[model samples]
Target: MCWDDGMVDPAPTDTGRAPADEPAARPAVRIAVAQRVPPRYGDPPALRRLATAATDANGADLLLVPELYPAGFRLDTDELAELAESRESFAAHLGAVARTHRIAIVAGYPERGPDDTVYSSAIFVDADGTELAHYRKLHLFGDETAAFGRGHQVPPVCRWRGWGVGLALCYDIEFPELARLLADRGADLICVPAGNMVGYSEVPEVLVPARACENQVFVAYANYCNSDDEFDYDGHSVVASPYGSLLAEAGQDEPQVLMVDLDPGLQAAARAHNTHRNDRRHDVYRGPDPTIG
Candidate 1:
């Protein structure tokens, strides 16, 4: 894991809220998050097998892979160009996996875009081999600025079985506004795919639950684990509930696929305790004209 003195480990400040009982009748979805995956050059068949086993073994309804799952996170243009996946092929392959496993899957890859750009992108493949939602990383991080182009728009919240799910990359969720925007749009859950390294492991432990609580939504953050030649990852994948509780977490250096339930009625019950979503004084804070909004 890479450590830098420039970045401090994040700590959640809102910790003392009174607890509320979650609704018992809420319908729940079984979700899973991956902590490690094959690198850029890994065999395609192997990747599919790993994903299949993950969903089948846990009977997970939805499975999320780390950011840039197929094409490694740190490769430069030349290497990435050779490894870049066309959106069509990426979708078709993952869609097939989803169909065979009867599990919805979220996978990330380096997508070749217009004008020779490659965007760090992801897609949600439904259980029936259909594409549900797609998103490009809106916020770029570290070496990503030079490796890929930035995305221009926010992805639409996906309607899954009855849950409204929002997607974001690693760094995007760190900025509260992104998750808040999704919550304001009626998102019941937010999914984050990350390439988190050491020293910055605090995100899943601290920031993820904070995002969930502040937005009154559930958050599943999946991260890459272990170290490669260029980087060492923190490997702590976690799922946080709207009540800021860490539902499940992986080890610092181990790879894991965690299965947890996200209950909408429970999220709504949590939101009942959290009225800030509608109570925020936006008039004083609407900084840029939403023409840019």
Candidate 2:
């Protein structure tokens, strides 16, 4: 149901009950990544500093930060209850910063959903501080399954700077199907807010670029850069191109901001050259036996 017959896949439409605004794009955009001081449990101030640090320096058109640093990404349900922010509150706060900085921002927080559910969430605010996409993480990592509720909606694709942009987070980007789905649905950029742990070089080094190369889309991974009780986070965050070449990368263990210029024309050329998606043999591919099903 997600795919159709075509030499090129069609643009994706929002399928969930949640509302989505019309997508807008630009020819080129500048993206900035932040590796900042990890937040402590129940600290919104720390979260604010992280946001400011991302934009307070040599800012760009868009800013990306790691997942739920407000709770240090290791909170128990009780801790999360204290740290999670209401949507309205978060919007009011981040929107002001985005508008003042004149930079679109994508940052993570633990959202306090109705019924006391806590969802690891990412909020996207435009340069004018208009909230664009508010997405919850779909793939929960290890202990996070016990700590957080999973988001139901598929990652929606929005247009930014004349290119298709998809929303995803940490473990979500580790899955091939998710990225492929985004790409097949005409996503030119995949922005991830991740809290990737130490020692998984394959993820940032292999899977990230692999997704970009195979899908012919730009992938930006923003991660935390410290060791805490919950994670020994290694911050080798990067922006990879459609051709799988890295545009920018951060230090392995420091607080830094990595910036790069992204051109949609390059993505267009890569998609034209990479036939992986176009060459799929759907008829030859099948799922498990009905008995197993």
Candidate 1 C-alpha lDDT tens digits along 27-53: 688998877844745456535654654
Give the lowest summed-lDDT range of ten residues in model 2: 15-24
- Which portions of model 2 show Cα errors greater than 4 Å? 1-26, 42-44, 286-293
lDDT of 1 at 53: 46
Per-residue lDDT of model 2, residues 1-293, tens digit only: 22222223454443311122222234578888887657765446853685566555455888888888566677578878887888777877788878777888888888888787889988887888887777888898778889899987767666566566788898888899999878756577888988888888678888899989988889999888878666688788999999999998887788888888888778768867877876775655665555663
The candidate scoring highest on TM-score is 2
Pick by lDDT: which candidate is best?
2
RMSD of each: 8.7, 5.5
Model 1 regions more than 4 Å off: 1-26, 37-46, 49-57, 287-293
TM-score computed on alpha carbons, candidate 1: 0.85
TM-score on alpha carbons, each prediction? 0.85, 0.86
